[model samples]
Target: MDTASTNHSPHLHVLHDVLTAATYEASSAMSVWTGGKISLTLDCVREVPLESISEEFDLGMEPLTMVVLTIDGDAGGTMILTFDEENGRGLAASLFKQEVSTDPEWTETEKSALMETGNILGCAYFNAIARLVQAEFVPSPPAFLQDYGPCVLEQALMLQAQCSYDVLICQTTFLKGEEKLNWHILFIPNPKIGDALQSAQ
Candidate 1:
């Protein structure tokens, strides 16, 4: 295998492990908040190409927001988590219980709840990664976005060009109240980070 492929393999495994742990953490957090069970299906983490999204959802329907959360690494790349609006709202609702509507009118408590939940989920993901890699990683404050398509693509391109590697996409699902929603997390390691992992063996 070439350098790129070789580097991608182990990182993907690391991402997979982190994602699996994150799924369990997210489900546990939701269960605690809602007093309901949360289960993740295997199909959740399977990566889907960007083109396949059209077949996944109805077009011409209300465009859902895709929120991307990225953690910039000291080595030069970033780790990102993206979520569709439906799943985002569902997660927000699951954590907050009230203020589940898609309205901009958010109470102070609702805002705090959303931020707290995002922090918790993001921390769980990175903590698993830190354990697997045996390195300390600190994530910046979480950021939110109300745009998708070109906007998301542009942001991803910026991160990729800076790191010179394609992002590893991990899809996640949160099930609650007879509802199943999907979210995505992208593991974009910096070139140096990739090189370190490749050279480890």
Candidate 2:
């Protein structure tokens, strides 16, 4: 195992520039989806212990709307997109072009909207990475859930636990026109990707 690849900080240091470069592609991807201009930027990224995942988002015990995507390939892992109630509803409403339901339960339309958003975001990153690593990266259909933030992260982390003690996490901010979407994507890459990334360099 490469210590540099599994370290708690620099594990993603190599990715900062790569992700920054991919920002344009990600933004373009979203813009096409929304049928208008959209900007997506990588806010921050780092490697952290399995248990410390929730700390990155300053999440408490609050339940959150989550969309989980499993990236399957030679090197694969999970990507989790999460938002609190206010932001989640706001996003759903934006896509619906109308007010969404106020009930705690998410309607089928709401679930589909969220999943499609997650899929778009996940594929943008995966597509960029695949080009760099020269490997096909496919994401499963996003799984929608409403649960405690930590609980959602736990399920995502479980997928990568066998790959490494420290997981690489990235935070992305997306905006549609002047509206800054308060949504986030937490990426946990499989350790096997270290080879692909390193070889690319």
Candidate 3:
């Protein structure tokens, strides 16, 4: 029997528990903003070789609206919130208290609405992660982009690839009412934060 392998399970379980709570907190905040109960479904949480992304990953063909933000201060890294056409417009309309149809092109007002949603949602998620680790995490002003998913994500992942080949990523999907919203949030934790998570155990 491998005693070391058995002992490692508890630490992994603890970390997963903490992370799950933080993610739920984030989803709750977003639900409030949307004036609806939005649920988040965790798609994947794992560490992957950065190099494999270019060769193996497909971010699908849907047009995406994305927000990219940097985490500064005690912990440094990046966060990205993405929405497909349906979710982006739906959310923007909710924020404006209006109805939005699925439009391939977004208006300036629509863009601003999505940007604001990103700012608020990104901060909520960052705060949760920061609290879990007891570290100060500040988010920079978000940059908005509307493009294909892979293209937009590639730009953000470029920075991570520079520093580490293996990165921790959590992908989640958001749902509004009975309809599933094409919303995704992907987080890349700083190396320092990764060390802190391990040391906390």
Q: Tens-digit lDDT track for model 2 on 1-201?
A: 011122343435666656666666767767776666557767776777776766666767878889989887546767888888887787777777878569977788888988898888778777777787777876798899888878777766675677777767777777667677767777777767666677777
Cα displacement (Å) at residue 105, model 3: 5.1
Return the lDDT, model 1, position 182: 57
Sliding window of 10 residues with minimal summed lDDT for model 1: 1-10
TM-scores across all candidates?
0.65, 0.82, 0.79
Kindly state the number of residue pairs that clash in model 3: 0
The order by descending TM-score is: 2, 3, 1
Model 1 over residues 50-161: C-alpha lDDT tens digits?
A: 4553354232244434434455664333434445566666666766565567686545554455556566666766666566556777777655555544445445545445
By the lDDT metric, which is better: model 1 or model 3? 3
| Cα lDDT listed for each candidate | 0.51, 0.72, 0.67
Which pairs of residues clash in candidate 1, taking residues 3 or more apart in a chain or in different chains? none
- Tens digits of per-residue lDDT, candidate 3, 65-142, equal 788888864355677788867677777787888878656667888888877777877786677667767877768988
Error of 2 at 166 (Å): 2.6
Evaluated against the true structure, the overall lDDT of model 3 is 0.67
What lDDT does model 1 reach?
A: 0.51
CA lDDT of 17 in candidate 2? 58
